[model samples]
Target chain A: MARVNATPRRRGAARTDELLEVTLELAVEVGYAGLSIEAVARRAGVGKHTIYRRWPSKAALLLDALSRVWTADLNYRGTGDVRADLREQFLRSAPALATTPIGPVYRAVIAEAQSDEALRATLHEMFLANVEQSTLDRITRAQQAGELVPDVDLTFAAEVLCGALYYRGLLSTRPIDEAAVDSLLDMFMAAYGA
Target chain B: MARVNATPRRRGAARTDELLEVTLELAVEVGYAGLSIEAVARRAGVGKHTIYRRWPSKAALLLDALSRVWTADLNYRGTGDVRADLREQFLRSAPALATTPIGPVYRAVIAEAQSDEALRATLHEMFLANVEQSTLDRITRAQQAGELVPDVDLTFAAEVLCGALYYRGLLSTRPIDEAAVDSLLDMFMAAYGA
Candidate 1:
């Protein structure tokens, strides 16, 4: 009786997973310009209304897809070494940024967001939330502990650290290697370290 | 005789200018995905063959259009003062980066460049030329004068300075205002000042 009840729930989860997987694959193959709900529906073998039921718009669907795959292993813990902590954060995130489908999807969405207000808001909100909750708090803690300069703007510091990575990933073909990671952390520490 | 000789040349130049203008406008309105040689030709009131004669592909046409309008007034002459120089550079370039048609066109091409390899090379080449010739040279000069640390990587320094602006312009809706300008210069100074 319990198995019977769980069967439909499991089936629904599997269907949602399949739809998301298709969206990720299609985003790269067709790009944001060529992507559409109808295309996703046709490719995924799901109804258009099924996608709309899960996400209000195509942008929302893409955002959901991005969130699931883009940030899978990005868990940062501060170990009192700000440089090491920041370096680790980037080193861990580098693979997803460089070689994965996440890179293309991120570039596509950001490119789309230039002309898209709704999508821009979603990206900004999601980005700011992550920075505020994790990055800002960590930096602020370091300031309190006298590990970082008291006057540094946490947001700007975060931007400088991560912006180089995003800049390279989006605009340049430069690999996000150990050297790049060291340069980013070294520069951030040079400016902000106490 | 000279007037007659120049008539066709002048007319050809005017026709090319019009086609390029339409291309720039359409890139923002419809984005790189929807932009086409047909649309540009139609909007410019020229034959499709005229556009083809001038540019070999959509990417080529877009690159040509971008080169004409963008970077028109970006003249960076750095003085001895690093803060003043950096601030002036950003100030000078802000109009092109934000207010003009150049911004949208630039954003559009960059969006397109993600999926297009040849376009990416063009962008990187153009970007690297500007940075290496002007930005990196100025920073290196300052370092030599003992205005900045000797060990600072000029390329990374240039990337950090401009990457923040590009990051905000492309990804976030943050206005590149006076405070932001001051913050960028100050941070660079903090890190590299001798």
Candidate 2:
């Protein structure tokens, strides 16, 4: 009886994965503007209600698809050097943003969030806030370790470092290449380095 | 003879202004997703061909509308203080972005550009490039004036300064208020100050 009950739960989880996979595939091919629930359902061979029952809107569906695959490993190595660690994190994550479907999909969500207050808040709570908090934690650790200026508020510093990259990469349409990262780090070192 | 020739020219310019005004009104009310050429033409009371003749696409029409009204005065009031000049420019421009239709419209265009390559290039060329150039110019002048560190690349410095504000104001949904400005300026002073 226990096995019989668990079988249905396992099947449900697999269905969720299949739906999310289909969502990402459609998102990459058609983009946010071109994507729709009917289209996704058609491609996935599932009823539109199946998707709607799970996700209220396209944006919500995309967010889930992104959350599943867009796991940017923010594990700071704490290699005894803050600047190198930051540079490592950025360089390591560059390919995830630039080369993958996550890049375009993520950009679309951010674009949609401009006019969407609720989506914006959800995005912040689900994604950006966590990235920011991790960055802040690393910065705080660096300050404690005497690699950064002690007792000075590093709130703006964290924002600037992360914000500048987002600006160049997303806003300015500039490629966030190695050179750009180096230049950003140089400015960071000058500002926050002990 | 001169007056007769100028009559058509003046009327054409007036008609253009009226069309653009209608476009802004519709954009603010419905937003980018709900906006369309059919609606714009119906509201403007002009035939669809009339708008199509002038603008190849909705993105083009919105760009023109934005360029006309989004005249952010970037003339850095060179008080020989680089930090103060930047702070003044940011603070002065805050309301123009935060309170006006320019803010929402600009955000919409930036959002659309993520999917449209040609539109992205046009936006960068028409708007963001000028802003970045002027910022670089101001920074160069500051470096020359010895108010900032000399011989530094200052390229990333400029991007970071401008980019940070853009990130906070647009991407992160944070207000570019006085306190935020103060914190950014503090980081700038700590990093690049002579």
How is the predicted docking of candidate 2 categorized under the CAPRI scheme?
A: medium
Question: Candidate 1's residue-wise lDDT over B1-194, tens digit each?
Answer: 99998999998888888888898888878867788999998988778998898788787787777667645434566677877887877877765556645676666777777766677777776553465356777788889988999976767777777777777677676777788788777777877888
Q: Per-residue alpha-carbon lDDT of model 1 for A1-120, expressed as tens digits?
A: 999989999999999889888988898888777889999999998789999988887777887777667453345667987777777777777765556556766767777787676777
lDDT at position A179, candidate 2: 94
CA lDDT of each candidate? 0.74, 0.80
Off by over 4 Å in 2: A1-26, A33-61, B1-61
Q: Model 1 chain A, poorest ten-residue lDDT window?
A: A126-135
Task: Name every residue pair that clashes in candidate 1.
Answer: none
Q: Is the docking of candidate 1 incorrect, acceptable, medium or high quality?
A: acceptable
| lDDT value for model 1 | 0.74
RMSD of 1: 5.2
Residue B158 C-alpha lDDT in model 1 = 79
Error of 2 at B49 (Å): 11
